[model samples]
Target: MSQKLTLEQIQNFEGKYPKQLWHLFMVEMWERFCFYGMRGVLAIFMVDQLGLTDANSNLKYGAIQAFVYAFTFVGGIFADKILGFKQSLIFGGLFMIFGNLLIGINPKEFFYIGITLSIIGTGFFKPNISSMVGMLYKDNDARRDAGFSLFYSGINIGALLGGILCVHLGKTYGWSYAFLAAGVVMILGVAMFLKFKNELGPIGDSPLLNIAPKTRKLRELGVLIGSLLCIPFIYMMIQNTDYTDIFMYTIGPLAVVYFIYQLIKIPDSNAKSKFLAAFILIAFSILFFAIFEQAGGSLALFAKGNIHPSVFGISMDPNVVNNGANSLFVIIFAPILGLIWIWLSKKNKEPNTVIKFGLGFLFLAGGYYIFYTMRFFSDAQGLSSLEVFSLAYLVVTISELCLSPIGLSMVTKLSPKHLGGMMMGLWFLASAYGQYIGGKMGASMSVTKENATLIDKMLAYTGGYKELALYSLIAGLILILVSPLIRKLMREVK
Candidate 1:
């Protein structure tokens, strides 16, 4: 019998990444395929199949996405305290599989129920995987960022395939096939994890190993049962956006209070300062996501009604472009960006994480400005150029590369090991707020007139984009101005 690899042994491996990283990468890739596929179809499915207005669909989409992210915070706490990352991930994956299967069976009747399960599943599956990745590297490893960048690519690759396939299947074949495909991929992800999880050794083992085995089992069972019990309540909240509003308002403040309590409990002042810095970054990310997340809501509608069906004179589905183009761009560019970061670091010229985040907002502003300019390029019937739309996604991908993966790496660097899952949850909880705000913004831009033309929609959506651009620019400037203070708080992390 072979001895399992210890955490130190895994962390000290003499290379850019551990072999186990690839296994986790593959698992995450398949899970993302399931996730992004469903995300691509949600708003369009509501509008076309469920007979929702654009405004209502956008609001519902926001509510759904918000729930998905908010639950990650809850999932993280549970994983940290009760199930450990491995069991939580497996439990989450199983629920996700079941959720998609249910939707596949009857999308209209069981939509909310399936979605509720998926939201809970994603909350559990998402944060733990990222935290596990963080455990693969030593605290000060120079390659941690690069490893995360590679992991980030796996997510985009899944998104790219899922985005293209799900929308194409849902549109051409049937919604069942599209959703079933998501379930199938999720199963593959879980299977892959089961096959290779031993490579993680003790990293994700239960924290309660010292306790009585029966007691531990009972606790874990309690969490699983508790999660299932919440499904009905979640279904109710999701079906009503007013309920979503109440839940979001209440949950966010409570999470903040919990975070502050945890912060106060940490014994080291330096660690506390880093936690504060992480919190600030997480807060700013809410604004970034609120603007960036327009891709799923208003942008989906814009693609459906107001965009040309050709890019560079080749015919294609505009919704497919809207859904998958950013992921494709990220796939192509993430490695190159990783190399650029390494090169800059070698020369002592790389910007700190705070500066990178601020630069992301600047790029985001530029992308939205391009989206705004699409109004000028519209033809008589209000259809705009797909080439220009692709250009905006290219810019937005750069912004995402700057912030999203780096932010993941940053949270791991800032947090104490025991709190890793909770902090990661907090990071995603910020995204939940962003999704909530984004839905409202998309709703605001939805043309409400009964006989509204494509031209009216183009005008309304583009005008909203212009406002978003101005707000993004102001945010970027503010972040840059405050970078020094944030950098001081970060101390030695960078």
Candidate 2:
């Protein structure tokens, strides 16, 4: 608006956030509580409620998540290109509210709807909110990373709590109650957002809306209403989970092609540099996610079936016991991780995005290797649950620290305006693919203990985990070695 506003002015806004950023942070925290809580229990619910085999249910959970991440980009694009970020976020949040409500009503009937709502909803809200936070600062705003870290921490608080909430609700009350709880939390998140619209204070508004005349605004609203009406048909195409691959292939390519077209169209001065660097990073990020995501799906079951929970005095259910290490790790480490970056920043040692990612996968490698190293124990235990509960999750969190938070921030930091949302979609596609692989891998490991020797079945499961971990380890090493070149390609950070 006024010379694009200096970075200093923006930082000042973060400081002066008309109504303490706490409101925004807490709302997101609780919503995450709902979402992650639902996730914590989703696979279990499918197995326990829907009567799907444990392997089958976990695959379904993973597949749905992959698709949801993929759509985050779509949400980003529609907001950036058409609806603007705030509107898109609002739309997505509302959609999520409805989706959760429907899930509560009858998840079996509206399973896809609930899941699709989350995908589309996250697409809109996730990227833009971060972008909006970014806009509150000027270029190279020193506090920017800290702000994100704080916001990122809010998300995990929910996730940590979710381990307890969804598990308890789903186990004791019913799966429907769990979904209903998730729905109410979502609605509260939306309400908190609407209440604080003024605090965002025009940051997330459609730029087009700002420029257009009153008549034009009304016309745009009319068009939006028409589009909203068309959602049912869109739902039809998205309904069949069986066509998941077709959706992944089709939507991903379309988003990419559209991004290429945008790269060709925009006059962002640094467009070529931005496109190349972002594209490479996006490509690699997918690989990072593909394997790292085994934590929740295949790995979850592994923890449930293989790991023993009762160690000292306290006896706990495997479901809760399984997710325990992750909850603890995230709670303890997230702040420390943020502080490390800050410490690094002061010394100019803060790694660039590419290297951060490479490190993320390296962490992935390290984490899975922990699993491999513990293979001896698992082998000895003959698939005892203890090995998985204590060892597997501990390893996964380190990897998650590497990939997850950084993944969110990178999308906001690197992606160009026109294709930011689409690139996010591509980023998610990587996760989707990883999840699909995780499922396929998990499904393959179902060699019946009845059919094979106990040693043989144990070998089958451990073998796959070790192989995947080793593969990720090598990939991480390669990324670290080449990080300098990748960093150079980012072309002297914005």
Candidate 3:
């Protein structure tokens, strides 16, 4: 009989990455294809097909996204306490497939129902996978950041493909085809995980391994059934939007209280300090994503109504460019930036994690300012330059490179082993707040006047972007000013 691989052996591998990372990467890529594909279509589908006002679509989009990330916190706790990562991922994937299939059947009628299921599935799937990747490296592994960087690239590859394909399919073929494509690719991702999961050895195995087999199976079954039962409640909440607001307001404070409870349970003072630093970073991330998330909300509408259809001399779909451009830029530039970080680190000049995060906000400010500048390039028709819009995405991609992957690494590095899943969940939960606020911001930018001209929209949206740029600048400065305290709390983690 073959000896099972141990976690120690996996972490002690020679070379830049463990082979298992690639398998996870492929799984994540396909899942992201499903995720980003659905995300790229949600607001536009509501406005174009369901006849929602742009403001309502943006608000609904925010609520949906907020629910998605909030559930990750719930899902993470479930995985940590009961199901384990593997079962959570499989169960989540199944829910996502069914959700998309439901929407494909009748988009306008089933949109909320389908979206509710996808939210639950994404909640279960997203955080656990990243936590598992963190498990691949030892504490204090220098290559950990690099591993996450590579994994991030995999995410964008899936995003780029799904973003382009889903929007194109929805526009040219039909909404049914677009949603069905997302479902099919998700099925492939789940199947791929099932086939190769053994390569992960004991990494994501059930926490109930010590219990009786029948009991374990029953518990897992219960979670699956329980999640399905929440669909109707979620459906109703999504439809009302008011319920969404109430939920968001309640959840944030409750999560902070729970985090504090957890923090008090830890035995080490240094660990507690590190957790505080993580919390601070997580708080700042809310501001970053609030500005960044406009791509799926206000920017989607902006692309459809105001941006020119050509990039340089090449004619293309504006929605496609809006959906996929950032991912493409990330795929092309992430590795180059990763290498640059390595080169700088060799000479001991690489910025610390806190500074990197601060720089992300600075870059975000620059990107949004560029977005504001698009108004200057507009003609009498309010059709602005797509080339300049694409240029803004490129700068936004740089900001993402500076902060996001590093944030993932920082959470793992700072968190205790037992709290791994929850800390990662908290990171995404912060994103939930960002998405929630972003929706409101998008709605505020929406032109509501009946028979409003495109120029009116251009002015409103660009004016909003200018305000966002200023807010980003202030946040970046504050983060940079506070970096020293955070770095001290981090101690030897870096």
Candidate 4:
């Protein structure tokens, strides 16, 4: 039976499929392409070109990612409670576009500005679009999960393409070209979104939509003028640096406090239970992401160090070989995973949200442990070839199936309807924490003659792997242990 579409509902219209959402997805794909693609080569760039040590590079990467998501807490609040979703996304995207463009130019003065704008932009963009997805569907619409699944597919499509293209281009042509390509694609994404504005309708709840445009314009001008006056003092405090931790230190805690206040403000018992679950979800997010995100750092390095290859009996370059695996995995597996969820749901065997999240962490822990154990083989067998690392990535990719796609879904699902973006913002906060911790872990892998030998380094990493396994095991156990309570909290939704 066809479900009745509500009258006030945003009509699917000629562009029934959420044109703004799709455009947003495409733009996000480009943005991620620039972001993660640069990430593919960034550590190497820092170490190889800028002559930074591995530890420094990893630390910088961690701090940057942490601040990027951390800011979303602030951005989401402004977007959800203040500016509403659409404006927040535009503000965020514009920042990201500007940042990517600036970084592509590779100027010292512009580099910081580019990253800063992008970071703040993502803070705004990341949470709001997701909340908009929530807005697209009404309460318990069967299509809600499907909408998120569609969104996840967009993410994978972008990430895979970004990694393959950026890594290959950076290695073969030039980093600048690779960066520029991502920026250009993102710009096109933005243009497409603007072109299709009529199709998007009024999906947003802009704070000032009721206010006159002139008043809003005046308010923005005031902010601009005030900011300009402070620039001289700001520049004195923050000297130009390509990689810095300013945002992590300053914006990070404030974001956390804001989230705390949000949790405290929940007026109803049911919403409070959901908020409680969201807090636990944050823990699981950290565990899942810290382990899964090794692709760009530890796993990336492992592939470089080991992994044997001769694709189709042709000697493929290692850089291409390394970059290509993730893209291939995402392309192949994402659709399959989506289908699996639908099938599971039809069979009435779909795992509850917490269980799914628990399994996600366990899967990542298992993948990393497999790779870490593979180290034993690499040393025993004399630096195992590309195939070894390839298998490892395959495992990580499967683990990603368990974690990455479902996180935001669970965020939207478990959160109260009114607080969609805030919950999504908190979701990224978990990722920000994971990014920070992952970077710290990666940085600790930096080897020195004084600290340990190659064997010692392997042993150290093994210890880290063991710790991750324990963390995941413990987190999974907690989820299962608390399953009854969380299920009760979920009430009739379960």
For lDDT, the strongest prediction is 1
lDDT of 3 at 474: 96
**What do the candidate models score in CA lDDT, each in turn?**
0.93, 0.66, 0.92, 0.65
Worst 10 residues of 4 by lDDT: 234-243
lDDT tens readout by residue for model 4, 1-494: 33434424553334224544576677667666766776677666666666666667667666667767776776776666556776666666776777677777873346545656667767877787777666665555544555566666676577677777887776687667777777777677567656654444566656667789888767655533543453343333223223235544655567567667877888888877777776676767776776666556655554554544454467765555556576578668766676777777778887777777667666666766766675665554235445555676776677666666666666776787667777788788878777877877877765645644445555555566667767777777787788787777775453
Off by over 4 Å in 3: none
Q: Each model's TM-score, in the order given? A: 0.99, 0.87, 0.98, 0.86
Q: Which window of 10 residues has the lowest lDDT sum in candidate 3?
A: 337-346
lDDT of 3 at 371: 97
Which runs of model 2 end up more than 4 angstroms from their true locations?
A: 1-9, 13-21, 211-241, 268-271, 373-375, 378-388, 448-458
* Model 3 lDDT per residue over 1-494, tens place: 36768899889989878898899989999999999999999999999998999999999999999999999999998898789999889989998999999999988888888899999999999999999999999997777888888888878899999999999999999999899999999999999999988878888887889999999888888888889788888898899899999999999999999999999999999999999889999999999999999999999999999998998789899999999999998888887777777777778788899999999999999999999999999999999999999999999989999999999989999998888889999999999999999999999999998999999999999999999999999999998998898999998876
Q: Give every collision pair in model 4.
A: 12-16, 307-385, 307-386, 308-385, 308-386
Clashing pairs in 1: none
Ranking by lDDT: 1, 3, 2, 4
Collision pairs in model 3: none
> Which prediction has more favorable lDDT, 1 or 2?
1
**Cα miss at 243, model 2 (Å)?**
1.1
In angstroms, what RMSD does candidate 2 have relative to the true structure?
3.9
What tens digits encode model 2's per-residue C-alpha lDDT throughout 1-494?
A: 22433434435663423133466667677677766777777676676667776557656766677666766666666666667766776777877787778888986777666766666666566666666665665545555565566666666777677667777777787777778887888787788788776656566677576555876567557645754664554465444446665666676677767767877776765656656677777777666666766656666666556655565546666677554457667767766777787788889888766667767776777667666554576645556545344566666676676666766566656666555556666666666667766666776765643445445555666777777777777877888898787777666562
